[model samples]
Target: MIDKQEQSLNVKMYINGEWRESSNIQKRSIINPANGSIIGYSEEATIEDAREAIKAAREAFDSGVWSNLSTGERAEFLFKIADKIIENREELARLETLDNGKPYREAEADVDDAAACFRYYAGLITKPSGQTYDVPAPIQAMVIREPIGVCGLIVPWNYPLLMGVWKIAPALAAGNTIVFKPSEVTPVTSKKLLEIFEEVELPKGVANMVLGAGSIVGNEIVENKDVDKISFTGGTVTGKHIMRTAADTVKKVSLELGGKSPNIIFADADFETAVDYALFGIYAGSGQICAAGSRILVEESIHDRFVEKFVDRANQIIVGPGSDLESEMGPLVSEEHLNKVLSYIELGKKEGAALAAGGSRLTENGLDKGYFVAPTVFVDVRQDMRIVREEIFGPVAVIQKFKNEQEAIKLANDSEYGLAGGVFTQDGAKGLRVVKKLRAGITWVNTYHFTFNEAPWGGYKQSGFGRGLGTFGLEEFQEVKQININLEVEPIGWFK
Candidate 1:
């Protein structure tokens, strides 16, 4: 557990293996959303600070000090970082919970996942095999994969450290230098991660972190010509802006954006299991997850029964400070976010969805200062309602009824976002059939909101473009080169 004195430590931006304040010395307060208290401060990096970080990464990539290391050697460095993460797991989890307002158990799980990600990528980097093409007359052809040079990683506050590790682990494993920017709202764990990088004795300028607002620091990372690629995880609006800005240099871009994922429950599903996963799906992380199953499409046959159980379970959730080990749900990230979520609840009423349970802020007892909202459930929702279509990053679930498999598929695919969805059924055939029809990158048969380090995670449509975990994630940071060799030293007739 972090003591009071440790919580007050000043956090600085990391650049070129050194921790320093912003060039302009601007600082932003880091708040503990669980209690609306200031935990510490982080440097609000200037455009110059961002540029220097980018330059550092570019120089490191060009110098080949880090990128030129053997793949096995690079793997060893990633393993060391993974080990350090395990050694400091408790502290990292505490910092994450404090900074992001998640339950300590959830935060601890994220730390484990982060370490696993590094180890997974480390193993992948050492695994041999590029494609070898069978050539026609007296020639050999093959494809070689190389790092894509400097990468600018922009991570969100929802899962601060885990998201950073998602991008950084794979990028580094692929031998790319990085300039990362953690969300200003939650920079605590990110700062700690940089310290771990230093502890692992990673080369200078190989990994950099700039803490600040999106306008200055984020924009610099996107517009900087030296940065070869951009990997961003955030809202869709900001993602589109990054895409447009990166177009100036035509840099490689990978995005994991917003989602209004659907969780479909058929009448044939195991009633108790579906009810449990339904609550776990949206209420986990207080519904801040990108793949959160906020939109529930229940078959009309089981709609009424499922709604009853789901609401009852939601009401029983223990909402309190993340530092409390027994708490099931923590506060929202900030007061501003609380207001936004409340406004959405009101909008749901305006759109004519019945609030089955929880529709207001919880201010009873000592919870007045924290941004606390109860686990909310809405029934009688239409496909076109804003509550059903928009990504509400809160512990709110909108339940809608579908007549049959075709209508269920239609309602599930009706949204502009398609990051993930799930189908709950006991029949193997039906589960496979429904999953195939859903227009999502990932679909769960009996589960929801569970991701693995071995699988690819991304979206199919406007939700986002590129994949994030697994070998595909490493490939995102790599460039493929096709090589051809002539065995007989013959000149081409066309060139002659």
Candidate 2:
């Protein structure tokens, strides 16, 4: 268990293999959203500090110390990092719960997944890459993948450590240096992750971190010419800004952004299973997931029955501090995010949606001090309602009814965002048929919120572009180069 003094220690930014204070010495108080108490302090980086990090990453890449290492050698570092993460699993999970306001079990699962991600990349990078091609007579051709140097990795407060690992592991595996920035409000776990890198004796300047607000620090990384790529997991609006900024230098950009994914339940689905998964879809992590199934679409015939069971489950969810093992759900990440969620609930009522279960904050049982909101559900919501269309990013969901498979498909794919979606039905063929029509990048037949490190994750359209995880993840950080050789020295004829 983490003691009080250990929990509240000051965390410094990691730059060029050293732990140091911010250039301006600005620090942000890290609050435990579960109890609304100040848990720690993290240095807030300025533009100058962000620039120094980028410079360090660029110099590290150019030095060939890390980039020139063999694939097997680099894999060794990743494997050690993975091993250390498991060794520190319990402490990191507690820190995650304290800093991010997630349930202890959820935090533990995230820690395990984070370690697994590192191991996955370590093995993937060691595989034989590049392909030889057949070409015209006397000519040999091939293609090889090389790392794009000096990556800029920016992750949101939700799933802080896991998302950071999602980018860091692959970039390092591809032999690139990086400037990593975690959200200022939740920098605790990220600081610990960097410390793990230090423990593994990762090369100097190969992995650097700058902690601060996105407006200053993130913009610096996006706008810097020396940074070769930007991998961001956050809101779509910020992603658009990054795309435009990176365009100036034509830096490769990978964005995994917003989602209002759909969870469709047909009448034929197992009643109990459908109801349980529907609650899990939106209530896990207090519905802060990027690919959360916030929009539930049910067949018209069984709509009422489904709503009744789902709302019952939502009300039974225990809302309390993440440290308590009894707590099934935790508070929102911060007071500001809580207000944003509450305002959305009000808007839903004004838009004429009926409140099915909860629509107010939970103040009883000492929850008033924390950023707690009851798991909320709005039924009879129209397809055009803002509450149904927009991503609330909270434990709020909207239910809508559909007539048939085609109608369900239409309703599910109507949204501008298409990150993830799910279908639940007894008919095996029907499940596949519906899943194929859904426009999201990630989908499940009868499950929700189940993701694997071996599969790719991303979205289409406004949900942002590019993929993360699997071999596709390694490809994002690499540049493809084509090469040709003249077996008979015949290249001179064309030039002559």
**Which residue segments of model 1 deviate by more than 4 Å?**
1-7, 490-496
lDDT of 2 by residue, 81-168 (tens): 9999999999899889989989999999999999999999999999999999997667789999999999999999999999999999
Model 2, which residues run further than 4 Å from truth? 1-7
Clashes of each: 0, 0
Give the per-residue lDDT digits (tens) of candidate 1, residues 1-496: 2333245858898889889887776579889887788888889889999998998898999999988899999999999999999999998998888889899999999999999999999999999858988877687999999999999999999999999999999999999999999999999999889999999899999999998999889999999999999999999999999999999999999999999998889999999999899888899999889999998889998888888888888999999888888789999999889999999999999999999999989988677889999999999887788998898899999999999999999999999998999999999999999899999998899998788988999998988999999889999999999999888885678864
**What are the models' TM-scores?**
0.98, 0.98
Candidate 2 structure, TM-score to reference: 0.98
lDDT of 2 at 460: 91
Give the range where candidate 2 is weakest over 10 consecutive residues by summed lDDT.
1-10
Q: Local distance difference test, per candidate?
A: 0.91, 0.93
